[model samples]
Target: ITLPLSAPGIAFSLVLVFLLAIGELSVPSFLRYPVLPVLSFTQFAASYNFGAATAAAVPLAALALLGVLIESALLQNRVFTFRSIGRGLLISLGRWNPIAAAIFGLLTVALVIFPLSALFADAFSLTTLHDAMQRAGASIVRSVIYSAIAATILMALGFLLAQLTRDRGQRLVNFLTLALFAIPGTVLSIGLVRLWNSPMTWFIYTTPALLILGYTAQYCAVTTRLSLAGFFLIPKTFDEAARLSGASWTQRLFRIFVPLSNRTLVCAWLAAYILCLRDVPIALMTASPGGDPLPARILTLMANGAPPMIASLCLIMAIASLIPLVILARVIPSRGITG
Candidate 1:
């Protein structure tokens, strides 16, 4: 009973991780693993074969769609409610508590602590970071601006779509975003190039707007999935009561739902922002020449830059992303998001 009840969360994790992995560029590139994303990226960026890139990405997107369909059927989402009246039994980790703690600590050290320790050690001092700022300041500024705008757009889209729960619109949206995410950024960039590179659309393709579009396509799933979980936690009775009291949809959504799930919305936006800010593949493929974002700039610098200078840029990127997220998490009222 408990396992069945946890299906949505489990499925959410699997789907998200699968999509992110499919589109990821760095790990596979570093390991020289000829993954589909990397293959598609090579075709577009290296060979300049937009057709071949599209062909590669389209099949992956299609496979992902099939998986989404399968998930939809197996989950029987139409019958699943976030506000279910029946609760699952809680299983306590009585004897396994120590073992679980050990595993958790090990993962934290390997994934987070060690990597950060190395970056900090290499960066050396304030002077190096200051020099990094001078060199890549414009790229950093563009990254922040571009990511913030994309995040805001996602937050709005997520909230509106989550309100359409159990509807065809929600299902269609889930399918589209998942499919878009599964397609590698380079392939999506190739599509954008073909669609907007002509004389009529040169203004959009030539400017930063194209990068924003690419970010939107790749990261829409982050906020939408988060919003669905967040809004679903709001008891339907709250919305029903508001409706019966003659409150408009907008009024109820803002006055009641928004206030209740404010933190989740903030978190959704933050997640999207971080993904956009640290983005490499999408920016690499779509950014105009000389206007590379921080991540792309870092990739370029790796060719010839000093190790300490590279470390400084990496540290700056971490600080730029971490500080805003930390501030928002602490400052925002966590009244509604219990978990």
Candidate 2:
């Protein structure tokens, strides 16, 4: 049926949205919400007790892990395989098709385009934008650099793990990533602090590397899933033929797999980049003494800054999120990723 055929795409979308949702800190902080991420953040930020913060985060982490387990069970073979023989008859709208299309178009405009247009219209002003730039310029640059580093590391590690999806350790690897992904950023940041706060690892821990590691641990599974989708699309016969031709493993991977999977790798990188750029919880918790990422800085400024300036910063972040989506849309079509 069309439902089964489309399940993987739906599941992927759900996972992406879920990851972004559970890790969000700014909105919850702003709205005085009881969300898990905000709870963890307040516990540490207010009290400075790592143990109390981690304890508060444990239940939320468990819930997230359970969500992942449920998703894995529901989406197991459905996600990895796209081919199926069952077909459902298409219901044609016939004379109403045009009317339906028009309604859909209007709905899209009302929901996505209109809200964005309003945000831009209200948020844009030279003086406010300049103020935002002055306040957030360094943080923005840091966000980009950190995101790039995190995305690169995630894509590399994810590629290796994705290649081993059919191996014996796949389930264990998947479970580990899921568990890490589920852990509240505050909890993970505290764990990282405890592990690296020691004298030996202090150098890297005190640097931006800690933030990059947090991002990688949280989002690597997303990259792995994206890369694995591409890997699965490629027929095993290509590898078999290359092997028969006496090509080395490196030769096959470089000459064949990498070239074919280029689109997937790019998609994964862009995904990770956007995740890091918009992240607040990890950025807040893992930031160095004098430095904070743009998202975290924005959250801080929003409490005290003028509404216009805050709007402008939020607008920039919104645009940052949209850019990768546009790139993915264009690249996917050109690269023939039909799903």
lDDT of 1 by residue, 251-275 (tens): 9878988888767777778888988
Candidate 1, run of 10 with poorest lDDT: 77-86
Name the candidate that leads on TM-score.
2
Q: What would the TM-scores of all predictions be?
A: 0.82, 0.85
Q: Write the per-residue lDDT of candidate 2 for residues 132-230, one digit (tens) a residue.
A: 899898888888888989999998888888777744577777778877876667667777777888889888788998888899998887787777777
Worst window of 10 by summed lDDT in candidate 2: 77-86
Candidate 1 residue-pair clash tally? 0
> What's the CA error at residue 240 for candidate 2, in Å?
1.7
Clash count per candidate: 0, 0
lDDT of 2 at 190: 73
lDDT of each: 0.78, 0.79
